[model samples]
Target: MRQINGQNSTSTIKQYSSTLLLMGSMLCSTHLLATTTATAYNANNYNAIQQTMLAEFALAYADTATALHNYTVLAIKSNSTTVKQRALNVALEQHDFKAALDIATHWVVQEPSDVPALFYLAHIALQAHEYELAAESIDKILSHDPSADLEKILAGIAPESKEDQTVLVDALQNSQAKDNPSILVIIAALEAQTGQFEQALATINRALKKRPNASNFILMKANLLSALGDEEQTRKWYSKASRQHKSNLEIRLAEVKYLIKVNDSMLALEKLEKILQKWPKAEEALFIAGLTSIDLKQYERAERYLVELRNSSQYQNDAYYYLALNAERKGHYETAKAYYRLVDGSLYAVSRQNLINIYTEQQRLNDALRFLTQERVNYPQHASFLYQAQAEILKKMGNKRAAIGLLEEAIQHLSDDPELIYAEVLLLDPFVQRDRLDQLLTLLLDLEPNHPAYLNAYAYTLALQNRRLDEARDYAERALEMAPDQASIMDTLGFVAYLQNDFSTAAKVLEQAYLLNDSVSIGVRYARALYMQGDLGRFAQILKQLQQKHPNDPQLAPLNSLLIPPPMPKSS
Candidate 1:
């Protein structure tokens, strides 16, 4: 035998030691085979020794596939559990989960009470998506070791896989460990994630029975009640939880959030004030109180809470944005602009938009354009949006040609940007630039085929020209289906119907659209549809309402002719 020594041999021996640890009891047998005299080996043992030597050589050289193959053969031929375990470890180290699963299953069959083998089998089955087999292995492992970490195993499952979640739920429901409160909690969470609120409620109630004072379970129950739309029960349970867990900030804050969700902003503010009275430095309570005050239009109180939050690192940007909103609502334009400039991160885009709106409302159009131009250079990632905003400011200033020119320049830089193309399409006069409008609309659809706004614009433009009314109707219907509650899409569909002379359909759909949003354009179409359908009284009522709402709307000028009485014939 060659003497093993030196740095290289020491490294190889260390690797062999780790490999032996995987083989468990086979380590001693392997050691004895290596040490025994040559005369002691019989023919049968000689083949086993030769294969073991080959596998060890493969491992030392880092030939994982060869090692796994030889080990798997050795494991099958021998009845030694350590040999099978070694093969399983080799397969696992190689990330050969299929071979690992097969070897683990064989190992378990040989030794049913092996906890580690069962654990490995369970995880392998989960990886293979063999849920039933995984469930069986998990059950067996739990039986052998009651303290097994089931949560760690279940964590691998995705919450979005409702079908897979349901299978696991059923298996756990019938499991020997079904009464485990930890298991019940996870099951409840999974049920809630899958939108099985009623079932989740039942599961959580069971956990609450085991641990009655568990604040998390109580909160889960309340949220489940909210999900089930039982508003009264949700309120009652949240109140009960708050009363029971007086020191628990999470429970109290959850109650405040629930109040806000139910639109009880006044009560939410009151609760938040109480929370702040106890925990004076609570940043979350201060933030919520500021927003709640804003909702109630108590500007002074909102400013006080928001100013305090400006010192908080977590809520600093959010506080600045809301402070700006509060100042704007109170008509302190300069203060609002100052606050908006300090806002950044995720709120930066909205804050900049607010500043632009403030400038526009103050009739400082040039200032708005200059600010947008500077922002585009500072934040190149938002350049397309800034260009769109600049174009709108130009349009507001009665510079439509400049707006179109700016958008054309933006499109040259951002050729694939759909929003820039759509903005330019909207700016183009349909009657004058028909081909260009059609070309951009086609391109916008290619970018986002199912975009409701793009589809609606295309349908409205086609209807405006009264060409291809059927195709226009098809596009409008598709858009309406995509955004069923969007009033603008409804208006487009109604316009398409009116263009096709389906006056009755137009009158019905346009009335719904008008009721949804009484915009001037939709109101005009509804009035015309009612007029064409011979509903003269309703048509007159709609005309009167439109005139009352928008006395000087240019779109309503054409409708004045409808109200004029026709010339009477002379009597003979």
Candidate 2:
């Protein structure tokens, strides 16, 4: 038992006492016994006991005095060198860094030629961010034989360690993980994150040998393979898991889901039907069956599955949401509204706001306002819904003050997140009180000088105000450089050029942006630039095209109702 400061932990004894408090607590046998017990030496049981011991030790050593007392006892109970090493590891995990160092220092002095002891100390120093101490510890290991294989490995290795991640990364990269298969799985997971699909695939294959039935390894390997566009192999691994564990219904369903993703809906449907036959009330299988139908565009089958699911009293957020999409497609706004409401006021609020679009499109202004009011009541501080509601309602009512007030409220949550601050600046740009927004912008530069959103927002605001076009132009260029292909960034750059009467450059940039994403806002700005440049022919072409896409958009009225003046004839 580890001590705290100087006190002997009656607490370690307290845990063994508390273990009797609920000897029948929720302990999964699978966690304690990964396989049928043939011997007492089970790694899974060892793992469980190790985790529980770690928890107890961490609590006991909250005071350093108690930790030292336990360390002295531990030093006598086993081979001094080996047991002392384990104590150092436990101390480090408990965040008693000085104690870990003290133990390591003793081990080094007692066994001056112990490479493992020196390296352990090096790792402890690294964890403390004592890079100088870490280097010195490693140097002690290298001094032993200078040419030893162990010394060569530690010295040759560059520790990009990146914290606890170092254990897995160093284990794999240092080529020491062949002896410890658990390290192989950690390496596979790390490589998967870094987009090294091939290396990740090979590592997972190696790890499966040590624990062939490790579900996490199989699932991760399947997902990584899927991410690399190998849908066939992804399903194969899931099927392999299914075959290994005959009664694993969830894992078998994972295989079915993968088939649906790969466009083999018929095969996925067969599996879903089997799952239903086995357990008729399996809501997940039913949900996926409906979703698979939706993916295949078999709308009739999707409607049937969804209707049956709803009748059976299954939880159906996805089903209801997709059915809402189905209703919207069939011009049934009232039906769509009901399903959308089920998902409305949820932490996931996008489903409801999308329904607002339908209300807006149908010109049911009262319904849209009612929906917005309800959303405001639900998520009181969610800036997105509040701002959208304010923007829509105030724009409809021509109440700029109320709209700007809502936008400003949204800005308060966005003080540290530069993107939100930038959006707030644009929303406030029309107001006379620019000082409030300018304050946020100046604070933002100290945080994110090259942020795409900040660069574009500052550029566009300066351009719109017709002040400091040179500064605006530079910011716009910087925004484009940060995110070259982003449609909104390109629009800012084009608008900055337009403000400087560089309309030719504006037309080029804006046209390129419009090609990438035909956003109504970008279209309006680009068309306006073409008109400013006296290129009304090009402007009219773009305007006519844009109006067709956004027929009921309020901005479309200006372009459509006003006849374009005739273009001067070209001299051949």
Once model 2 is optimally superposed onto the true structure by TM-score, how far is the C-alpha of residue 170 displaced, in angstroms?
11
Using lDDT as the measure, which candidate wins? 1
Worst-scoring 10-residue span by lDDT in model 2: 5-14
Question: Can you write out model 1's per-residue Cα lDDT over 1-572, one digit (the tens) per residue?
Answer: 11211111111111235446445434545656677785575454556656777887888899877888888887767667556656766776677778877877887787788776676677667656676787788778767666554544544443357777787777777777788765687688888888888988999898888888766677878889988999999999989888888899999999999999989999999999999999988999999999999989999999999999898899999999999999999999999999998888899889989999899789898988888888887889989888999999899889999999999999999989999999999899889999989989999899999999999999999998889899899999999989999998889899999888999999999999999999999999999999999999999999999999999999998888988899999999
Task: Please give, for residues 1-572, the per-residue lDDT of candidate 2 as tens digits.
Answer: 11122111211211222243113111433334545665546654344344444443644657444544455344433234434644564575466767766776677677677776666666556555455555555455445634222212222223454553455365345542233444465466667666678988888888667667666666767888888887667777777787787566767787887787677889888878777788777778777877777777777777767765664444556667877766766677888888777663342466766677777788786667666767766766665655566565666777667666766666675556554555456557434867876687777776799887787777777777778789888888988898999988888888888777888898899999999999998898788888888887888898889878888788877766545567899999
TM-score, per-candidate, Cα-based: 0.64, 0.52
Candidates' RMSD to native = 10.8, 13.2
lDDT, candidates in the order shown: 0.82, 0.65
